[model samples]
Target chain A: MKLRRIQAIAVKEALQIVRDPRSLMIALLVPLMQMVIFGYGVNLDIRHIPLCVLDHENGQQSRNLVARFAASNYFSLRRAAGSDREVAQALDEGDCGIALVIPADFSQRLNDGGRATVQALLDGTDSNTANIAAGYAKSVVAAFSAAAQLDAVQRRGGTLQTQTPVGVEARVWFNEALESRNFIVPGIVALVMAIVGAQLTSLTIAREWERGTMELLVSTPVQPMELMIGKLLPYFAVGLADAAICLGLAVFWFEVPFHGTVATLLFTSSLFLTVVLCIGYLVSVSIRSQVGASQVALLATMLPTTLLSGFSFPIEQMPAAVQAATFLVSARYYVEILKAVFLKGAGVVELAVPILCLALYAAVVVVLAARAFRKTLD
Target chain B: MTPSAPIVEAREVSKRFGALVAVDRLSFAVPPGEIFGLVGPDGAGKTTTMRMLAGVMRPDGGQIVADGVDVLAHPEQAKRHISYMPQRFGLYEDLTVDENIRFYADLFDVPRDVRETRAAAMLAASDMLPFRKRLAGQLSGGMKQKLGLTCALVHTPKVVLLDEPTTGVDPLSRREFWQILYGLRAEGVALVISTAYLDEAERCDRLALLHGGRMVHCDTPAGLKARMPGAMLEVVSPEPRRARDALAGQPGVRGVLLIGIGLHVHVDAAGRSAGIAAALAAAGVPVSEIAEVAPSIEDLFVALLDNAETPA
Candidate 1:
């Protein structure tokens, strides 16, 4: 493989991207747009759930209980229901996600030292949000029960203790606030690199085939490896630039921390970019049409990266078949690396598995792309 | 002109795409400084044969040697000795004419100093210097073809293969394009050009006529014309179609072809023209004039195709 031949192809490709405004926009502006959209638009943290109250007993105790539910930021009181039937109607109409019904004997039973239960109705249509809302309701009720028990102990002339025996303390590492944005922004970097490196590289060779330049190029003394490397160099630069922009936005703009060294981030990103760009070249060489290549790139990179990479959904929670399939997506490993470097402060030694996976992916894809390209020339 | 060793040779070259034989047992030799034309109609496997010789594609069977190098076994090395321009010559529409030329030069590893001088000469010869800064997409069809030829020849390869370089260009551009080709020939470069136009075949030193992926005839234009089966007599009639019908399958008449405003009937002997005229006249088809004439390349091709279709 001659360096001059590779340089010639690289220079020509760079000129094409620069001269064509559409390609430039795809390489630069699209990533920025995706950063803003994915950073703010898709929030998994559900809030401001509407609540309806059906208070049959209009007593102070019932009102106090209603205020407790209203105080928390997670639930907003939409309206009051006249009866149980009205509460059921509200839940059925989808007007409120949570409904609290206080029984008529709630105040009497509590004054007599007898236990009283309030029925909490919840809508389970959107199961993810509904499950979170249910968890919040259970916590509130548990806190109220503990407070009542403490009052009973204090009135009996005994000291009340707030701490329970054998209490478990849960601490979240890296993301103290558990802000989804901190986790999501890093994954977005992997996604952006995949699109810029693979999608753009996929179109390069296919465009040459469409324009009839491949025949002319093949007729020269240039080898297949030279052509593949030359075509990948420019797009790899674009992918790196896109990764940098996303990382910058995630760190400064979105306030996500970058705990690892810059070298580690660059190294991992380079390996991932190589893998994706080789996949793009393979698709272009096999399909040999611009339209077909673009479609294949979109399907092969974007959808799988977003859905199957455990970016938004945890791989552990996915079905076994899906968990096994995630191994096939290069972004899955890259996402792990990005999250590790940006949030966990992990170095190469601590993150060897993902690094090895990415390197292996890069090596295999490059070999396959070279072989496919040689076949195409023949 | 003195004969020289063959710069390009193909032995029993064949290509198959599944069930279809694109090129069947094709063989040809092109000497240095000669223009060899591959003449055929659409789907006649002209492109396939040219591709195999240029080393862009390998033949399914046979040997292709270019400049003493076996192209099939060592295509990359063989590529240095030849240049190929496909029907669509892969010009970068986004790049300027000068940029396009420089790119090919760089790919071919032409020295910087040599590229500068050679590119200047090519642009000057093709009258493209004024439009060097223009984008390739903005150039006229003819100018694009000229630029393609210039880029292909910038490295000064020993052989050049052009596939239908003048298919869609206007008549004037076509003439100018051929003039540049002649200039290359004068520089001792071997050219293998495929064209559908028989008139272009007349310009080559020797031409091969392909039909249905098989070579039917290969000879110089004059030699192929000399191989016409029988004497041709031009018949001018007020109703030429009626006269062709009257002469069809007539005794001593080998074939009847309708040329514009007349019919050229091939008779087995020159003495049989009077019998043909008498036969047409007896069939109530009046002939204004009749005379023996020499056969054109078109006439010979038509006759060859007729013979191929209905074999004796």
Candidate 2:
């Protein structure tokens, strides 16, 4: 409760972090590394899918159809198969993700004004990539058919043409390009903050216990709450600094947009940092060992923050049990706030729920950590 | 020195760990300017008792009044009047010597002027002024203990509790550490230090011998030795073990203890030494010297344990 006492502890803890190179590396370098690696390494946008063609007819129409698939950036033509067996072999060997099989009677049927059919086969091992590739193929074939009908109409000298009754023009808001990095980089701020704030503090009190400094502190006039606050203040600053670094990298380095003001970001980040640091302090108080505290902090903060915060995966698609468990993770609410402010340009009004949740989590965790920290060795 | 009111008192304090009793109805008082030693072997509840007095642990039964404040009820207030140094000095290995001392100064909210003066004085007294900028981890074992003492004495509390402060320290450092403690006592500070060394126990103004969570004896060094039940005869023989075996459990002999190249036989009276010498000679253990001598603290401790076990 005393300011001088708290300041003393904070200064000592900061000195320790500065003196220990390993802790300094964890606080500063680890976040930067995580951002760079996760930003570029994990890509959800699929491109340059290899495609194989079986042109049995070897006609102008078949070659034109194959050129359309090649012209699109989504697909790259690997080879032209002479038979169905060869196409199958290429698909089975994983040489191509998609195959276009043009029948021999395709050009003859079209010249006779009869409909011709083509077969498109896909490798379903990686289902997400397979589905997206199939959709692109379907769109390409539809465009070709429409253009062919228009040519036929002009040749017959038709004055008018029928039009589809309905049109669906889908627009993706927030992220116009639908780039996954925009969403992921913002969420990385929360994850990095959790690691620097919680994991670093998780070792502070435990280190004191191991080194026998807690006994001296407890024997003095310092209060438990004072010790807890002092221990957390330095790491809280480190966590905020880490958050700022991540924000800069996301906006300038990774090219993710930043729609919110620095004030809002700092406000939300402070609340989230408080919650995580309290969790770390509580773990240290309970375990009271350096190695044990580090392992528990990783499991309690980093794992849950990355997995349950909807940072890397969608929480809506998670099983009901895990969905319920996400409520206990403070990172879930922080991620929501970051994504909203960064992508949606949402203000306090738009992010009332998540902001309130973060404040509540901070309050509850601070109380619990203070309560768990007793002045006695017992 | 004239007797005065106690600066620290424990009234029948007891501590239990599950079903095991670590401290049983312990009672003691430390007055101003007196060095009280809690002398015991390992697991004698010396550390536990020191922890309770320091207000870092609560005794399940009875009361601990430090500086007239009930430690269990107002631990924070009680802590302001006492400084505790644990078995390990607890110096932050990463912090510089000056930083560690300043940390304790700030925690105790010592006035800036007082802190500067006291810190310089302590450093000079402990001969640690030259290593103020050095990291604590790099300091020698002796220097570390001195630094721990300097930090603890920063606030100049009324009572100081030290738990086995010299257990790992070298003999020269142990002597220096005792010199600093003597200076503190001269300043009218009450000190309660625990140690496993019997020689160190002799340095205390008074000491309590603890065994199995109970205080077997509590008196000054000379007083405890004076309580030795009967005459102690030093027997010098070529065969010490055989001499001990021959003399032990003989007529009028209380106990026989081996004390480095000689046998100390406790007897009901000084007159019994002649009978013991005859018994040793009959058992073919030749004795060259036999004479009555004053018992040391070790002899008293062993005799106390023997008496406790036999209950005579």
Instruction: List TM-scores for all candidates, in order.
Output: 0.93, 0.94
Q: Please, what is the whole-model Cα lDDT of each candidate in the order they appear?
A: 0.87, 0.88
The ten-residue window of minimal lDDT in model 1 chain B covers B1-10
Cα shift from native, residue A237, model 1 (Å): 2.6
Pairs of colliding residues, candidate 2: none
Q: List the residue pairs that clash in candidate 1.
A: none
RMSD of each: 2.7, 2.4
Per-candidate clashes come to 0, 0
Among all windows of ten consecutive residues in candidate 2 chain B, which has the lowest summed lDDT?
B303-312
The segments of candidate 1 whose C-alpha lies over 4 angstroms from its true place after superposition are: A146-169, A319-321, A375-378, B1-3, B236-239, B279-288
Instruction: Report the alpha-carbon TM-score of model 2 versus the true structure.
Output: 0.94
lDDT by residue (A1-378, candidate 2, tens digit) is 889999999999989988987878777888899888878887788777999999889898888888889999889999889888999999999999999999999888876778988899999999989999999999888877777777677788984474667988999999989998889888887887787677878888888888888888888898888889998888888887888888889889998888888888888888988998899899999998899998998888889988999998899999999999999999999999999999888888889999999899899999999999888988
Residues A156-226, candidate 1, lDDT per residue (tens digit)? Answer: 78796766889768899998888888888888888877876778788888888788888888888888898
